[model samples]
Target chain A: MQVTRRQLLQAGLLATAGLVIPALGRTADNSKENLLLSSVTDKDDKNWWVLSDSQGNILAQHLLPGRGHGSARHPSGKSAVIVGRRPATFMSVVEVSPQGEYKFTDLTSATGRHFFGHAVYSVDGKFIYTTENDFDNGRGVIVVRDISNDYKVIAEWESGGIGPHELRMMPDGHTLVIANGGILTRPDQPREKLNLDTMKPNLAYLDTRTGEMLSKHELPDHQLSIRHIDVADTGRVWIGCQYEGMALDPMPLVYHHDLNQGGLQAAEASMDTWRALKHYTGSVVADNQQGIIGISSPRGDRVTFWDNQSGKHLQDIKLRDVCGLIPSPNGKQFVATTGKGDIAIIDAQTLAVTSESRTPELHWDNHLQVLA
Target chain B: MRNCLLILILLCSTFSHAAEREPEAYLKMLNQALKLIQPAHQLFADQAEELHNQIGQLCQSPSEDSLQTTRNQWRKTMESWMKVSVIQFGPLLENDSRLRIQAWPIRARLLTMGIKQLETAEAPPTLEQIAQGTVAVQGLPALEALLFRTDALSGLQQGQACAAAQTIAEHLIVLANTLNQRWQNEFGRDFADPVNTPGGFDTPQEAFDEYMNGLVTAVQQIKRRKLEDPLGLAGKPGKAGATESYLSENSRDNLHNNLTALILYLTGGEGYGVDDDLIAQDPDSIAVLVLDDRIKGITKYNKQLTMPLEALVKPATPEAEAQREVAESIFKELSLLNKAFENQIFEALGVTRDFNSEDGD
Candidate 1:
């Protein structure tokens, strides 16, 4: 493709300065005309906080645990799962009230000494699974517990990868998508060396019923580790990678899976395929309809747009280590939560941040979840 | 038409292909380095983990003797990793100009080394180890080639702390040289158009240069406006109420404007996004928007433009003789940033513990 002056200008700016400030005037056009995105702040909220559009005035919100990024809600929306990290990696199972208040009726996995609490509910909401790193041996495990009634320690599944970072419910009801990061680390220590030599990302589908490892796939050796996963509505998987290189280079990459093939396929087919595949990946998610996958790297400060079908690069936008990305309630917009803690909304079509909301408590705002 | 396009492409390609013989030597050297350094990075990481575990265990123990013993062991482990990482990765940048620019694995190794020391140190060491480690730790930053625009000095200090706690400012100047060389090399490849390069960049090179330049310039300004000089009102204006202070807020703001100009010029006037309107604001007026809570010196202010800042650090003791100490501290920080920046750039090119950036495709 012939390079346009605009493309050249943009590319030049991105390479030199490492930043892109969009036109600020776009924020005036309200995304949700009925519900003002302005009042979407979590005000001195104490016990329960949810992003709610309950009155149809805004999107959905819920009161999750104080450290919200570590938890995931079930696809069914019947129960909200929250992981608390202090004292230990603790999970609180709460019954969600219509008013967005969570009744704290249950807590699980509190006995462990150091729990780096990363948990997700099964598609059916019958089980709650989380990764717990044993501080003693530097080993990690995927604790599959029974939350059928409140929460209980049903079974524990060991993460095949050294540090299993996050999990998602694969479209096929039987499999749980797990990102087994190959970095061996103690709970207190930031991930030690990424086992680069024999490092293989354990992209596996564990049978939730038996807590047995069914199908597992690994990444190439040089890739430091795989940490995040987003399963599309169609059962395809988008995985985000981190800690591949230092801050200078691109933040590794975002990979997609052939729902049928069991391993990661090229996120985009053309253009130096392998080289592009290894950039540091971050949070990966499919939109509400699961048509497009959104991948952001705060380190790379860019979010790539991939065509869900052919896996072509439709476009990419310059943003920071966008640690967290979520589709708007309606899926017309993408809400990107940066590592610096600025929340921005990008139009699904234009792929531009239409609005931004910066909250005071934005330190390392890693993930964003829409409470039903 | 196809032949003509091909000829045009070939002619364009030749000028841009600076070191293009399949990148064989560079790739081979990188692969060899990865084979060696990947193990080293991992070993250091593993050792750091072990030390952290031991420290954790020691902290749990009620006995002071046990704690002291554990601290010693931890220090030993840290010293070992720091030495191996520097030795293994530092030489590559020193030896090869191309590697200096493209070798990310070496840089990744260095970052891991710094991270290993910082993370494993957990808390500041005992005064004795702190003293010893200061000498050892301070040198790591000087070895780093890539310097981050933000927190470069802090990163250097982090390296400095690991060295033995005693400041090593002189080594930092050397580090700055390495960083400048690496940046020039990488920037030349990543950004410069034929006209810009006096040599040309490949499509990928051109694209990457633009991308990095824009991204970096934006980040600098973002940090400047939001994190650094909010409005610039820092540093006393030079003169009395003659009219404007010697370093009037306007001048300080102007300094920020100048820093942006510097970044734009350095990056080929392509990457920066600060519009002309913002650039046009008086330097002193811009200087009035300074913020305190953020790190100082991250954005510079001067008579003309906001200078690109080094990492902001705690102000030193106030005394006339302290001038030497301040200069030493500045030198130390610059060295550390240079080393760290080089490491970051190397890693960005795809070189890491096990993977060389050049090996990707």
Candidate 2:
């Protein structure tokens, strides 16, 4: 008999409650037990925030009113929050109880603002910071929410640029690094970029405690929209950029900024390698343990790896529409998800696919998260 | 649940069949497309050279006959470009060839500023200078403003304006020849054997997907940029000024050529083409039927328009109103054509519609 998603989720809940249902055919691999979370559009055209084991088994899910983009897992591993895609008006928080039950709370965007599809939890998990577009004012803002007070908005700070995207906290736990994309857009126009010629993208380091801008770095070319980022434990930040200029213009799509170095430097790659990326980098992730950085270009249908220490190109693996990437729990491998419904684990040292599975029913979105 | 299982089984069968189809079939289609495309590029180059020569003649000795001949040659060159613009891959995508040949939705303000600078310059800009300038003033749209805009005839009769037009015409010849040479040489060979050649596709399916994507994007450009934006069918008041080829009054002809080129691409000029592949997958495929009917419907409505697109969009009289109606009908048919490709053709052919191209962060 075929198992339904509802039944599988129920089995997961029961297992979490210390009751095993052997008839449900749970795989016997407790060593690889972390749950991967992603926003997906299913075959039936429904949006969902899903949690699945490394083997691609759906464990829990919550239907979303709209498409979701990035997700953040709470430090305690008991909850995760998913933000709707850009020009977003809703965010969903899903909490899993020890009894295997799921509680979902939906939050609306603050007035005159829209979520930029990414958010981060504080090191203590007491607050959540989200990037938003203050459309009427033509500025990007960071909204701080008190996770303990029912996710209430407590403060807002300037993001120091126009179209700020992904943000991450530095290892110091007091600084927030933001990728200001620099393309001016309004809620009325939605995805239509209003400014490209005069846009100035920057990498900003902000003191989260006082809402002060610490330092900001900008690229010489104004059209490179720095969109996504990943920070290693050692405080090296990797950024992925999407170029808004002509397609024929050869521009590097990945860059790194070291807190100690104090400048934005392009990742060293041959011009041929840069051309193959099709001028778009959807996601950037780093494995500090192995000193490797991986940047994915869904437009180019490949994921390229680089030496984190030297910023030199290493190798690329071809995977159609592969975007979401994260370091595995052990930091010895990388877990990747694609829009084609593929989940793959690549050995960090050899860059070999250790395991892969395809669901065909779920089209994973841009970002992925792992529940600790 | 039972119905879902049945659907899954059917999809798996279709997918396996698509995978098992010989790569030779797709290669044959690619070769056939090249056959049509190579000569189209050659013709465009030939026409550009002729336009260049005619402009030089008119500039050397200004007259109504010479100017008219030069304008006529420009029209021929533009028509030739429309035929091959559907092939947006390979050499056309390399080195800014497409933009250098014909950058459209022309930045009118920038073009005017560039022209003014050219008019006051001490010497006429050379071909290299034109090539090095901004894309807005380097190609056919710029030439159109120089040769067809108000007072253009007087402007081009022995001054810096005529010299600027001449240099731009020369630049077009160089751009067109480079595109044709690259397409005929290495890129052509690599494209033919996509699975084996370096810098080529990884699979025959990928090559086929590229071809289909080119065709689909062309149709979408025609519908959205050519029609909807100018006609205000996309939820704003119609702007006659936004119509492409407004100065030349050739917008309707450009649309007609675009549709003709799309149909030719689908049929592969009477050879094995996408249409054949669709029928081979399933004889009663709805995608093929919709595609054929919509093309015919669009062609019929386009042919019924008695006025240019700019005038039809403004609709000043009863006759213009009828023409506007015909234009709207064409937009509807183009919409249906785009839908068929997006919904059915990609799935039936086992081609994955690119996610990032459609929606990306």
Tens-place lDDT digits, model 1, residues B92-195? 22323212222222333444464356435656544344223322223323222112213333443443233322222223223334444433455333332322
List ranges where model 2 is wrong by over 4 Å: A1-37, A48-63, A73-80, A89-114, A132-141, A145-164, A179-206, A211-226, A229-281, A284-363, A369-372, B1-28, B116-129, B151-167, B196-199
Q: Candidate 2 chain B, which ten residues in sequence have the lowest lDDT sum?
A: B11-20
- Evaluated against the true structure, the overall lDDT of model 2 is 0.80
Any runs in candidate 1 off by more than 4 Å, and if so which? A1-68, A76-78, A84-88, A92-94, A104-110, A113-117, A190-198, A243-252, A259-262, A269-278, A288-290, A339-341, B1-361
TM-score (all chains, Cα) for each model: 0.47, 0.78
Candidate DockQ values, in order, are 0.03, 0.19
User: Scoring model 2 with DockQ, what do you get?
Assistant: 0.19
Give the CAPRI rating of model 2: incorrect
Candidate 1's C-alpha lDDT? Answer: 0.44
User: Model 2 over residues B85-185: C-alpha lDDT tens digits?
Assistant: 88866677666677678777655677777787887788999888888777777889888888887777788864589889989998999999998887787
lDDT of each: 0.44, 0.80
Which lDDT tens digits does candidate 2 get at residues A124-210? 999999999999999999999998898999999999998899999999998999999998888788778878888999999999999
